[model samples]
Target: MALAHRILTIRRDPHSGEVLARGGDPEAHSLLERSGFVPVVRRHETYHRLPTGLDQDEEIRLATRAVARLQTVGYDLDTDPVFATERREPHYLSLGDQVRHLAVRIREAESTEEVADALTELTATHDGILAALTKVLHTAADFLQDLGHPADPHTAARLRHLADERLHVLASDLRHVRNDLADRQAVHPHRAPCPQEVAGDEREKSASCPCPAPARIPTTPSAPAAAPPAPAGRRR
Candidate 1:
């Protein structure tokens, strides 16, 4: 998803000097212009840095504030129900489950090495989810731009396409990461086996053991290269 350009337009108060607001849509500038105001060309506002370590309540609060501000400007900034009702709620629930699982593993860990490994995996998974969410937010911004209610249609369409492509790739990566973590948990219910299990005479030399192994199973193979088609002839 493309990063949105934060447009800074100059506005003047009755008694104060010039002030700037982060302008998005053209209609806003148009309204100001029609009301006997002039738009001054200046440097655009830098993008606001996102807050880190924000809990779900903080996130909802921030989002609600933004929506409220937009509402005052006659813009309808509704939260996507799919994220709230379906994807995000479930995703967070699953994340909580994973955290609980990791906590249990940490508590039941036999050694410091086992606890460290589990914590590392949990941290990596948490980071992966954060990156996925960032991608989703960026995609949403691009999607909003593409609605063309306040932006140029051509530019919006291009941004929309790019956003769609990016979202697809991010979603695919997220799915792969989730699946890998799930597979790892299923195979390695606990920490690695002790030396006794490895040295046991009853231990089979089978390749398909339901335990974490040095090697991973190949999911799929690459397809053969396809030949390019001939160029089409021009019609008379």
Candidate 2:
């Protein structure tokens, strides 16, 4: 039910005069973030706002682009006049979506070796995703450490700590697990790779060839309604 009804409102706050966008699905939120809006994640709901200190024209451009992109993906937007646009900008896949395919591969794999191969793509030392993420964190930390803001130094330190400690441990553990899986050459008992071809003795061509359906639990059938009672006056 989570992204069932995608709707949003883009307008300047009545009191603060800051451009704000609220009430959207995750896809709409991602579009706003790509369009240069900052997300304000609250306990119950999340919303986006134009980052502070932008010129009015720049703010309008970002807001209008967000509206266009969200609308292009079929979101219903209630927008202010300045933020409304007739444009329906073409959408592109985000980098995060591309990276998520690794998880899909692992899920669909029928053997430990296949899973290990997918994990190698993530834990590979040279250009793996974790390596790239470590670089991004360090790059951000270096930029923020000397920004002259009082809180920025601590924020940068937190990022450095995460990259140096938590992420390193995770990558190391995953590397170990991947190596172990790579050594195992057995297929999963509950899963097998389908050949995607019909066997010579197959009876029904339209039915599943070699793949078997997942086992299902038996459900109790409801009792049939009792037959209507015979008319007592006529029969008895």
Candidate 3:
């Protein structure tokens, strides 16, 4: 990330008197939210603020903790005096960081089988990522279904819609793709492995191997010219 993106400012908003944290990347935002700050999202910016009704002592404590969390992970923070802390909080791998490894595996894959292996973690029958996510959503919905809020039923239904209609559809589609690639055993066209042996009828005995040239970078296609207007229609 850019150095600018790693910088944050935490101070009380002069007008609203709310302890607000501004600037930084999504990781910084995650840290602030994890420290009990609520996110305030706008069209052009997103920031974090201490939750409403917090006593001054609790707000300062939370802000100090947030500063420490950011500093330990290499973020630079400009904070109010009360929120300053020399201590650093230990950072650990978040579930999101673990999930990001799947993308890395897919990106480095050179064959259909390799890709399928990476996707299998997400599409496996009972214990897969999507399956677990669906279960979590359903359970959350069940909890909300009995809540006393007027919107509770609608929120519960929405969760069920997401778990069943949206996530289930996605899981089914990916499972289909994974099954198709299970036995493909096909190497990427542009990523063939070295044969390591020369052909018996080689034309050049001195040649090391008969590998194809590297793949070319595709050029961006230009827009087509606009067609000429048709001639005026004839009168009856």
Top lDDT hit? 3
Q: Give Cα-based local distance difference scores for all models.
A: 0.46, 0.88, 0.92
| Shift in Å, residue 132, candidate 1 | 11
Write one digit per residue (lDDT tens) for candidate 3, span 2-43. Answer: 889999999999999999999999999999999999999899
Q: Which model is ahead, 1 or 3, in terms of lDDT?
A: 3
* Candidate number of the best TM-score: 3
- Model 3 residue runs over 4 Å out of place are 196-236
Q: What is the lDDT of candidate 1?
A: 0.46
Backbone N/Cα/C clashes per model: 0, 0, 0
lDDT of 2: 0.88
Q: In candidate 1, what are the lDDT values of residues 1-236, reduced to their tens digit?
A: 11232232232223632222345465434433433334566486321211445554554444444433434445432243311211111112335466668778867766555555565553344464444555555666666665757655656566555546765576566556545554553323355463433434545676244444556777888898898999999999
**Tens digit of lDDT per residue, candidate 2, span 90-143?**
877778988888899988889999999999988999999898889899999999
Residue 146, model 2: lDDT of 97
How displaced is residue 208 in candidate 2, in Å? 20
Model 3 CA lDDT for position 102: 92
Q: Rank by TM-score, descending? A: 3, 2, 1
Error of 1 at 36 (Å): 22
